[model samples]
Target: MYTNSVLQTDYPWTKTPLVASAPMLNIAMAPLAVSVSAAGGLGFLAGGFDVSALESNLEEAVHLIKQSSAPIQETYASTAVLPIGVGFLNWGADLPKSIAAIEKYRPCAAWLFGPRSIPDDLRPWVEQVRAVTEGKTKIWVQVGTVAEAVAVAEALNPDVLVVQGADAGGHGLAQSASVITLVPEVKDVLTTRQVKNDIPLLAAGGIVDGRGMAASLALGASGVAMGTRFLASSEAKIARGYQDEVLRVSDGGSNTSRSKVYDRARGILSWPVQYDGRGVINKSYIDSAEGGMSDEENRALYKEELKKGDLGWGPNGRLTTYAGTGVGLVKTKLPAGEIITNMIQEAKAILQQLKA
Candidate 1:
């Protein structure tokens, strides 16, 4: 099993049972990332499919971190590396710009995901990032299956492995097991293969609160990475209607389904065939899956919805509301820092009670 000590050594200021915000493209921006890190957890800013804004985003994050409290500033005063992390979608990210931003800003971690090909597509990214940062920026790869975990571990040897289950939001493998089975299985396989045991595993998917965090820790994860839970954070770069819908949904298991309908409707077809997104089931999904709505028709409707702004999202709205199965657990919009601290405290209480 993995332990939080591994993460603590890499991120000296982080607290135990590490809570990290998943870099939900465009949503997890500078404020959210900085706030989470300031609260003694890891926060990540999405580098997005395009790397054009990455440098500016990092600059803003740097400014925010400097303006942070004395403790946060002092902790990072000696290191040139930024405390926050940046996540990239390998399939569409421009390698040159991505490498340049990483080289310049040197965020504590670079989370690589959605590669068109395993190991092969990831090698240059891993090598170049390490070379430019001199290992200051840790490599964290998000994998959805045991095969990817093993392959990446054996070949790339990422500093951290984020095991994303099928229940996760945004983009991930269309067919993958839940974190309950995936985390332990990956650990067992890596151990049996004599891979580096010190590499920590971060569980992602359907983890919203302390209960979920405690359960993940018990399942052999050193930490938890939450995307959906952070969607409700006040710092999240989300629209009013989208956030409201995130709070309105319940029984995540029934309300959210994995499909490419939303992506197609939004005109984003660059993702690999095996990958799909999990989001709230809305008219857009229903129209395509059941109503037999043509792709062109759905795309046209989605365009109109975009003009409606906040009104564009909801059960009947045509806009995309990508979220995880644990969306129900996120009821209110709170500061990213509060969410981090509260979850850590809640997890601690639950663990102590369990021991008792």
Candidate 2:
């Protein structure tokens, strides 16, 4: 069976039942990524559709690592790879630019998602990143289905597989199972196929607290990656209104829904058709789905709300509030480091209690 030992070996500095922060666009920037790493959890900075900011972001992360306390420095002293990882949306990413950034920054891992085609589109990225980083950088491919997972494993043989469920926030497959079923199914398929390498699986989607983390481990995940949970982190580069909405919302099952509505309103139409994003429901969604508002009209109003700054979010607010089904569990805005450490402690305690 899969175990945390695989992850501990890959990421020597991390604690057991590894916790990672999902790379959210414009939010999981240098500060949040570095802070998560310092606390012994892997953190990923979102490379987004555009990679122009990647080098500058990595530079800032390097500076932060250098200025970190001795204990944090010691955790990273043994490896040449940067402790934090960088994630990319492959559908719209400029491969050459992304490769250039990875070549220079040499992040520990590259979390890839939303490719136009499986294995075919992801091949060059995997080969080139490995070539440039001399295998120092591990490739992490995200998939929402068992077929996609098996295809990637057979072809790219990625170092890690991030199994994202339908409950996840931001971009993912519109039709996908929850982690409760997806993780084990992927594991079973990969095991049956006898993929040459034992690629570690990291479960993502709807997981907000230590309870979710422990449950994922029980379901055979090597680690858990949380996006919504970190949206409430103090270091997340999110607007006050957006962050406040994330904390204020509850019952993510009913409050959040997956659709391309926000992307259309924001004029970001580059994602693959199969992919959609999960976010808190608001006036914008209501006006479009129920009130029969046109995309053009919604876009216009969204732009107007953007100018309102912190007032643009909430039930009545029109701006997008991308979050997960577990948004209700994320009630506090703690430091990213504290969030990681606390979750790890709580997950361990819960797992121990279950063992007894």
| RMSD vs true structure, all candidates | 1.1, 1.4
* Best prediction by TM-score: 1
Q: Please, what are the lDDT tens digits per residue for candidate 2 over residues 133-241?
A: 9998999999999999988899898988999998899889999999999999999989988984567888999888889988888888888999999999989999999
The estimated TM-scores of all candidates read 0.98, 0.97
Instruction: Give lDDT per model, in order.
Output: 0.91, 0.88
Candidate 2 achieves a global lDDT of 0.88
- C-alpha displacement of 309 in model 2, angstroms? 0.8
Where does candidate 2 stray beyond 4 Å? 1-3, 69-72, 75-78
